[model samples]
Target: MKQFWDFGMEQAKSCIFPVVIFLSLAITKVIHLSLIARYDLILIICLVTQVLMVVTKRETWDEVKVICVFHLIGLALELYKTHMGSWAYPEEAWTKISGVPLYSGFMYASVASYMCQAWRRFDITLGNWPSTWVVCALSAGIYFNFYTDHFIYDFRWVLKVATLIIFHRTVVYFTVNDRTYKMPVALSFVLIGFFIWVAENIATFFSAWQYPNQEQGWHLVGIGKMSSWLLLVIVSFMIVATLKHVKGKMKQAPKLKTEKTSF
Candidate 1:
């Protein structure tokens, strides 16, 4: 049906950046290049794709900026995680900083790119959105928890509960074939997190990065990562929402009197 085809097209459009990155990783594995060389190729591919997205008008300048910001944020986390022995790049690369590859940042950037494209392509909008300050506070807490969990208790469950409460009434509206559809904001976050977990498995299978266990050989990434991904999705969502100016309602200032007030 036309509706089905339209839905598929919208989804594909949103996924274009992620698909390209994964395919590049696959090709890198097949070619059996050196670790540094593979990372170099991936970095080049990501840069080219970003340029092309802008040149082709597939992404606006603002969207590109948001994606770049995601890269920085992701790279910061990568540096800390790699340093803490959370995971590692098994090969050497000139672009590496403390065992983390520069290309690794693009992996996070791809998520932001997908979100930006999906928002525009699907005509997505948010309703009953939670206060931006509340979301930001939760996001910051979740991010810090990633680093603090080793030294202290992880309140991931508490954060998750708070996330649900904040987003419980929020709805995401999108269009397919000119017909609008709606879904719960929390459900969408969980779904995206699930898919990102699946992709993480595939990325690890290709040896993009290795866990402590995967140092010997490939294996499935732990299911527990889904919770982390869920938190990250919220972070990414907040960034995109801020950029797109879809944070609940925008209040217009009241009009002033046309004539000047008497002294």
Candidate 2:
């Protein structure tokens, strides 16, 4: 019981960015802003929130860089997906490009931020991690399928199966307080994806954006979307893992130099 409580507390701490964003969404929905557009206001809030996190030592610069990369990746997908009519930002804003608001990318960034925070707070490490090339190949396929599927065949299910096979042996080890816990990496992806899907429903409920069906009225987002989020969460995880791996290698470089000099 105590371990569960500690785990929940750590998870809540890791969710700071996402909670701020959701609150901004809900608050902006009901308030009237004369000078700034609602979308632009949200963008400002996100930027400020990120800066504050860095200033307060809640996030490292490297983590911020990773989050930025995810932001761009997500924004590009938004541009294409919106053009394809998958979903849309119906509100008018100066910060919008080709109908998608810039703030939308931060929604994706928030996911990366949560992963980074949780990793640090939980002292996370991976076991039986796959080789770099294999991980990159799978990540690339998953991302490209998000685009290519709209034009050609939807290879998501194929990619999903591939994910399970590739990561079947990988385990995530994380510490909660003094105790440590482990879970299958694939299962972690599904759990994070499920939560993101729930967050998506809340975002749409607050009129953050609208789908075709929601244009008439708001309703629960379909369960099928969880599959998409699961794949996306995998991609996000692989990217963070790669960056962390690179950083770990870089940190060992000076140690290797010192060892050689001592010999």
Candidate 3:
């Protein structure tokens, strides 16, 4: 019971960024602001929340870099996806480009923020990690498929199979408190994806954005979206993993140089 309580607490702590985003969504939905658009207001709130996190020492500058990279990646995807009519942001806002609000990218950044925080708070490490080349190729493929699928064949299933094969042996080790726990990397992806899917429903409920079918009335997002989220979570994980790996190597370089000089 104690361990479960501690684990829940840590998970909540890791979710602070996402919680702030969601709260902004809900609050802006209820409050009417004529001078400032809701979408722009949400963007401001997200920016302020990020700055506060950094100022409070909750997130490091290095992690902020990772989040910024995700913000760009997500914004690009949003531009393409909105152009393709995957979804629509109905509200007008100054921060919108091509009908997509800039705040939308922060939605993706929140995911990266959660992963970064969880990695630190839970003392996470990967076992039997794949080679860098394989991981990079897979991540690239997963990302491009989102765009290419609109024209060519959808290879999500194939990518899912590839992901399973590539990560079958990999395990994520995380500490809850004093005891360490382990889970399959693939399973973790699915779990995170599921929760994100739930968050999606909440976001849409507050009119964050709407699918074509959802423009009429609110309904549950399709279960199929969970698979999309699962693939996305994998991409997010790979980005975070790559950054951490690079930082680890950078730290080791100084030690190696000193050792070589001494020898």
On lDDT, the candidate that comes out on top is: 3
- Please, what is the whole-model Cα lDDT of each candidate in the order they appear? 0.84, 0.90, 0.91
lDDT of each residue in 21-110, candidate 2, tens digit only? 999999999997999999999999999999999999999999999999999999999999999999988888999999999999999999
Clashing pairs in 2: none
Off by over 4 Å in 1: 33-36, 246-263
Query: Which ten-residue region of model 2 has the weakest summed lDDT?
Result: 250-259
RMSD of each: 8.5, 6.7, 6.8
Query: How many residue pairs clash in each candidate at the backbone level?
Result: 0, 0, 0
TM-score of each predicted structure versus truth? 0.91, 0.94, 0.94
Candidate 3: residue 187 Cα off by (Å): 0.6
Tens digit of per-residue lDDT, candidate 1, span 61-109:
9788889899999999999998999999987667877789899999999
**Per-residue alpha-carbon lDDT of model 3 for 1-263, expressed as tens digits?**
89779989999999999999999999999998999999999999999999999999999999999999999999999999999999999989999999999999999999999999998998778878889899999999999999999999999999999999999998777776556677789999999999999999999999999999998899999999999999999999999988898788212111122222221
Sequence-dependent TM-score of model 1: 0.91
Q: Report how far residue 213 has shifted in candidate 3, in Å.
A: 0.1
Ten residues in sequence with the least summed lDDT for candidate 3: 249-258
